[model samples]
Target: MHNNEQLPNQPTGCGQFDPRFLAQIRRNLFSEIGANNAQGLSKNLRQQLEGLPRNVRKEVVEEIGDQCAALFYACESGNVETVDYLVKVCGASIEQRGISMCSMVHEEDWYFCTPLGGACAAERLPVVKYLLELGAAVNGSSECGSTPLHIACGVSRIDIVEYLVEHGANVRQRNHSGETCLMFAVLSESLCGYLISQGVDVKARDLYGRTALHYAIEGGNSQTVQLLLEHGADPFAETRYGNDPLQTACLTGALSIAHYFIIRYNYTAERLADTLELLGTTMIDTSNTQAVMYWRLANQLRWAVPRYIQKRPEILPRSAFENRVEFSTGADLDAIAVDEDAIRYQGLIILERILGIGHEHTIQVMTDVGYQYEHSVQRDSRKCMDMWLLALQMRVQKHSILHYKTCTTARSIVRLMENVLHRNVTQNDPNTLRFEDVFAMFQLLVSNILETRHLLSVQPISRVQQDNHDNTVRCLTHLIYLLLSTAGNQTERRLVESSVRDLLRHDIRCVRTNESLLHLSVSRLKMLESEYVVDKSGTVGIFPNVNVTNLLLECGADVDAFDRTKSTPLHTACLPLNHDREVVRALVEHGAHLDRPNLYGDSPASLLAGNLANDVVLGKHISLKCICANTVVGSGIPYQGIVHRMLEGFIRAHEPV
Candidate 1:
């Protein structure tokens, strides 16, 4: 026999309902029953099924109408009469499956549930009993391997759970994630106790090796946690990620659970101190006032009064807090409790000590701690720069210079420099920012850009690489503006000039847009809308930056070079949002044509004429040589063969719009 062929006694007509009857079932039977008008729903359903042929009527009982079978809907709605009518009178299959909309499993993915599973999830005890009496599989599972018992326990239907166990529900069965019903029942103390008494494993481990005690602690129910502990659940059971119950409790802010474990469990002193430090750092990040309590607890465990120092790990990094806390006494903890900066720095110190300097999360916390200092009421720029600089150095060592983590850390440092420079210039606070430090950071930023340009030269770039490329260009422009602002001496000015020349010598352009440095500096589109472009100190960069433009021009950047839009840098300066005539005069001085056109036939002169309509002196800015070239171009005579190639190209650029 063929594999596709059905046996003679096998039910073949199931799910073969007539189209009209299926529509009627959806239109009347399901809606009315859902609206709680089940008194006549059975009669309405039977009448609708009677119009179809016998085979169709028998199959219509199991036909899936609206993402589920009619019997499944009847079970979920608690309409036992309709459910019985479909099973008995219409010969419906007791184990019919359909899409479950209210599955206890993952709601984001699709899961198929049996009618018995649906009834149990809805807490329809009567329908559940009837379906079980009709011999529906008590252990029938959904697509996610969740049985009726799993559903009952998840919804805390204790009565149904007891009834199912009295019959034949398996208490030890695990779902797809290897989670038993007891794992989901840990939220309810009574349900957990009942499941334990009925042979559910108190020490059951999920796919991740998490025990019921982990779930109990995560639920924040001290009573449930105590019950699980009394029933022999391991308090120190670690998951695949090495998270014990106490670690989970700390991460979840379950103070009572942490306290219970601390007093009741026999953890070693060093392990307890580490976990307490983790808890303290976590609480500090959330602004919880209780952080000092945990820190003091850890401190007491590590150091006792009168002269007792804990054994220290050899070769600790400079990022560790060993230097700051070497001589701290009880009075130091009290000081940290009142000082916000002390609390924040203490958190960073503890995080780095526990997670190590090479960990990514440690580097991220360093950056965040730096931000807290930079933006806090104290405005400690020196400390902020120190932390950010450390983070940037570590990120560069761990990942490539073009990596997103490295790029983000570098961007933060650049933003800080800009803010400090703006403050120094506008508020006359020169001591707030240092020119040497900003110059050093600028050198690193330029090296990263050059390396990225080299990578794009020999290889195809992904979308992320393209974004990093654009970000580097934007950061470089912001730094250029800052360096110009802080150039107080000839030495500083010479350094800035040399760096600009080095970049232009590389022939670098934005890989994504193919825009030259001059184009990005002139337009300032990307920098204006960047996510890191915060102007909290009102330090917005100047638009159409004439100094950066002139600097690029002096560094051998093509003043009339065309971008991807086929428009020169001069076209960008003439834009409505960036219509700065000083930049226009600078570009014209650098030999930019007055009548150069782009792909859209919009020349600088044409655009400027529309923008500066009242400024009749605009013509004075256009030299006589440009006017003659514009005239020759408008005459449409063949100048390509009659003139020098350079002059022919100039005439072509001056074509009238």
Candidate 2:
């Protein structure tokens, strides 16, 4: 046992004061506080010699800081009355954090200060509500970027989630990992649905580039995948490493999900090849004693073989190598035969390749084998199994192994990429090929993308090389342009919208990169729209494709960006007869400056505030767009339902009804 003096940052050498005596004093103080013995505590505090030494008393007072120790205990115990008295009578600050003298990391959010956060951690929702009403920051984030709402949602405290949301906790707020409350809610489909309905980006990627769909797929929750898809989650959304939902579903053996994508989309063969490539090898090791132990289990036994062979060196003698030898029924020889029977198995290669299970899972199988061998090796009762060594008397056939030709399919995909992606795609009219078909071709090409990208480092881009780059970019840019143009055609729009986003995924998901295609698309859009500055494309064109706009914001776009005319995207959306609620909501959710003035000293908010139709058109029972547009964050008035009612009245008076 060590003294408190040995502990890092623990104080020591207080005259004759002992550590054991100090521990007893701490225990007594907490016990009294826990029992709410205020009179006993006051008496103990007055009796300095009996309670604590004069020097220790100064140390205790200095360590905890001015008399707010009671507040931490009260908050931990959910003692609201004591908290009220401490804050009001003693002038204790609710925001006051107890600074630790120790060198360890502090619980910046969960404790120290923040009575509201403390009460929430204890599931004291009523106390949480009370503290919030008394002016606790609803959006106060903890050390790990977890807000009260983040904690509540994580613990499935829906009541707390509701309260925080209603009090204006930002639902779009990300944690330290760039995960949203909605990402946490994926484990609960109902919560996920509600968050999606609130306009949280279904397209949002976490730090790992996994969308909500990726999480749902990885979790094997098919129903949750359906829910995210319904909310416009892109099926082809890729991680930074390029594993999309299909690759993830196949890897996890989510057959229902893999089948769902296969039925809807094409190129299942190419996708499987990519999965096999990711696994590093196409075949598992096969041996004769397969029924007893698989390749994975046998691989672990290989290490023990040398030790076992050393014990029975006669099995590897030079005399046996020189002359034809016959083994006698010796105990060592029998033990070797038994050991061999216990661990030798063949590969189940082709099926494993198609199923997508690999070394990662077999590593766990090793643990399972060890546990079973330890617990059941001594069992006398025989199992329904045949040992190849014992049953056949060592006469089992030693067959040659074969492997699946995954690379054959991979080569075919490469040829297909060279065929499709080598030509100028935009040279032909976008209407010549359906955007959906073009995007499917793009998915296949990129899915089977050759290591030829590595060649760029080896040599300069030639005319042929530049053609390859131009063709892919042309395919992507044209797909985006066509998708934008075909917004009036409902079925085509639905079919190609996701593909357009898929093409833009690289630009959208990256925080910093060359958006050559995206920048070109935006410039082309402005060039295409010479007469009209705004279109009523709610989720798409009003302010650039909503997907492109969102990707820009995620990649750090300036919200108050002005064109040569000093008009922001907000100004474009608010132009007469061109207003879109979804576009405005999207902009505001990403922290777009509401009051950033363009040229001529006019803010976008002022433009909307002047327009009665903007409010009326955005009119609904607590319309989010109205809240988003009107909720000037620093104005002190967050979104309120009453604000909607007031606007609805203004709309009714202006309308014929």
Candidate 1: misplaced stretches above 4 Å? 1-268, 285-289, 303-331, 400-409, 424-431, 454-461, 524-541, 613-657
- The residue-by-residue lDDT of candidate 2 on 1-657, one tens digit each, is 111122123344546656555554444444544665433243443343244455555344223423335455555566566556445444445554432111111122232335555565666686677677768788776545656666665555667777888899888998766767776666667777777766788888888787878877876778888888877899998787456888778556565787687677776333433343222221221222332222223223333344421111232222201222222223323333334322211111222233322233332232223223223555211110111011111111110000111222122222222222333345353213234433444454343223233443444333334334334443344444444443446776655555544444443211122234433333323322111112222113322455655554554555545454455566565555555555566666655545545556565566677776654322332345435443444354444454578754433222111
Candidate 1: tens digits of C-alpha lDDT, residues 105-194: 222234477999888878999999999899999999887788888888877789999999998999999988788998777778898899
TM-score top scorer: 1
Model 2, total clashes = 4
- Provide TM-scores for the models: 0.57, 0.35
CA-lDDT, candidates in order:
0.73, 0.46
User: Distance from true position, residue 44, model 2, in Å?
Assistant: 9.3
Which residue pairs collide, candidate 2? 287-346, 289-344, 290-345, 290-346
